[model samples]
Target: MAQSFQFETSTERYRDEHFLPYFRNGVTRGPMTAETSDIDGLADRSRTPPTVAVVDAQSPGNVGTIARAMKNFGFDELLLVDPPALDPDGEAYGFAGHAREDILPNATEVSFDHLVENYHTIGCTAVTNEDDHSHVRFPYSTPSELPDRLATVEAPTALVFGRERVGLTNDELARIDEICSIPAAADYPVLNLGQAATITLYELRSLTLTDEETQLPDLERVRAPEPTIDRVYDQWAELLEELNHPVEKREKTMRMLRRVYGRADLTTGEAIALLGLLRRATERPAEQ
Candidate 1:
């Protein structure tokens, strides 16, 4: 069943008046369009990644999945509120994969109030209001926008996810400083608890991880140098010339070869091998 909640506007005025201007400006808008200046200003500021917090989570397996997602995204700290037993031998531990060694075992159990008081809490929800009439879910940032919204802050923060069944209560969301939502079809926006957590964490990974930390192969290392690529083009021209490829058509053929090689993004080794083959073709006696 999709978890849906009706929110009251009793606290809307309070949030508008008390919270940061960014939040107020975000109301009635999608993805904080008017807050670009605010976000850009904070772009170079120090960043402290938020702790992943699950509230009133009923499923141990879901909790484990969240932990694994955290590990994949370079986040470590986790806080649980009213969580089920995560026995070492149980589903939580079993599903945690490598995270059981660190994120799950070291998770802290804290009250919702404690989470709010100690950190800048951003609640994750699938539901949101379209207009400024309600503050609880309106003016929410989508998960992809979180890194920009949070890039400047240095304070401790928590990315709060609610129960698998009903999600966070309206009251809990009312107290949260900000709201983050994953964009989905309007008719059925709800996502599985673990999937929601995973997607949100993946979006926020830029704040927690550096390019070097990800250890992905550098493009410079894999791609042939411009000079090397030029050599391949030169070789192609030579091969075409040796074949008595018509002079009028040779230039066009070379142009096509350039386009093909440009799109291929051949590696250095591949380029060298192609150069050798082209040389051999050019050197071979004309087949008569």
Candidate 2:
């Protein structure tokens, strides 16, 4: 006779790491939306690990896969910031299997800023160096840096990954405190969204201790939010437009500005400082 199985309630699913509970008659079965209560129950029991947010991703399959990877890697929080064409519980659960439906039912849908409000440290991964090196100047941080920095963390941290196509917008990246990238062949630099999430989580997972050990970076190292960068850039753009400066000159000046501040990787405080400076500098010319 075939064995019988039934989906667990929300409370039971949080602790269930594998899909066994959802199997019916010894067959793995996909849960319909009604089963989300089980996943919710699971979520209540489990403490969220650092969240991994995939922003503006286009493929639902990839989203499901990433959630699966997160569950495999022991990350509890899977956030989707502005994803396109997603049916959170329907299509994604098929890919997540039974182990990680918490991500499916309760996947936090938030703006980058909103996500950061709860997280103390946010790391963003980019495909290319992209003329900015605030979070990482070296190709990779030493193994020591990972555990040591992660150890001191007092609040929830988020590993923010970009979209499948363009990756994190400058605006999105700007909001993060640090940036990370997987070492890929130069010929083709981009990794799929799922691949990037898996690798990053893999690297981070290796650092956990029997006792939680997460390092906090010096406050100065944090980068300003992407919106702050947008505000600064917008100011610069407005100034150039107001001056009616030659396009080439404006472009050149903006490039130089990027080189200076982009390398410094301004923190939240630092960005505010710079914006204040711009406001002062661009104040209307005093009458002679």
Candidate 3:
């Protein structure tokens, strides 16, 4: 890869005449990690190709469906979190069909903490919004929006799928970096695991790859974690209150600001600048 990071939207290979395609490009043999036994088939976990992580799933059939979807979408790394141990001879193989032996056989089982510790970025799937406004998983992004949201992350990233029945717990969702939702018919919003996985993978593939001919202005990209964003928002809240902004509107105003900052996708420096701006504007004896 020309750049340290490789970007691919979905199962399709993004090939440019001027740039080497990741799928067909030089894959020089590399050494494995010290913890190599736990992670399968990857030397550089940081630049993990698009991956899928299953959480507490019960169905072998669904896992098979997911594996088949992975094959269709060009995803190879699969992670399982407390899911029913895969039955190799079961419907999983039947559904995986061609990918049955190759990708499915290598799926790794890890803890929720393991995912948080390893991947550079993590996205969890959900059909409904969490009731708590302050939940880390809140302010969800659509599957189609995910690739753009994570365009800068060169390290390994994963899209996590929860159980068919209840989906991800708030705690599980908390450990993730973002939520990728599938917008659907309001009357029946949710889809089955297989359907959801396929749609998500397809949208991920559908993103237009940037090329030498592509017209775009590159900005200063930065990585700001949720915790930092929250701290900045809290400082903003103090500023709003100092200015006597109505109590009824405080939460709403904070939310709007969060959306503004979140959309900007500021780096640590950018976030710090904004936080300092608010403190300076609201400087008072109490605040000082």
* Candidate that scores best on TM-score: 1
User: What TM-score would candidate 3 get against the native?
Assistant: 0.54
Q: Write the per-residue lDDT of candidate 3 for residues 211-276, one digit (tens) a residue.
A: 332344564365788788887988988888899999999999988987888788878887788888
Ranking by lDDT: 1, 3, 2
Tell me the whole-model lDDT of each prediction, alpha carbons only: 0.80, 0.62, 0.69
What C-alpha lDDT does candidate 3 achieve relative to the native structure? 0.69
**Which one wins by lDDT: 1 or 2?**
1
lDDT of 2 by residue, 17-108 (tens): 32443342342223334444455543332222566788777888778888887766666666778876556466666677653447666676
Candidate 2: where are CA atoms >4 Å away? Answer: 1-48, 88-90, 128-145, 207-288
The count of backbone overlaps in candidate 3 is: 6
* Predicted structure 1: lDDT: 0.80
Global fold similarity of model 1 (TM-score):
0.74
Model 1 regions lying over 4 Å from their true place: 1-47, 185-188, 217-223, 242-246, 277-288
lDDT of 1 by residue, 84-115 (tens): 99999999999899999999999988777777
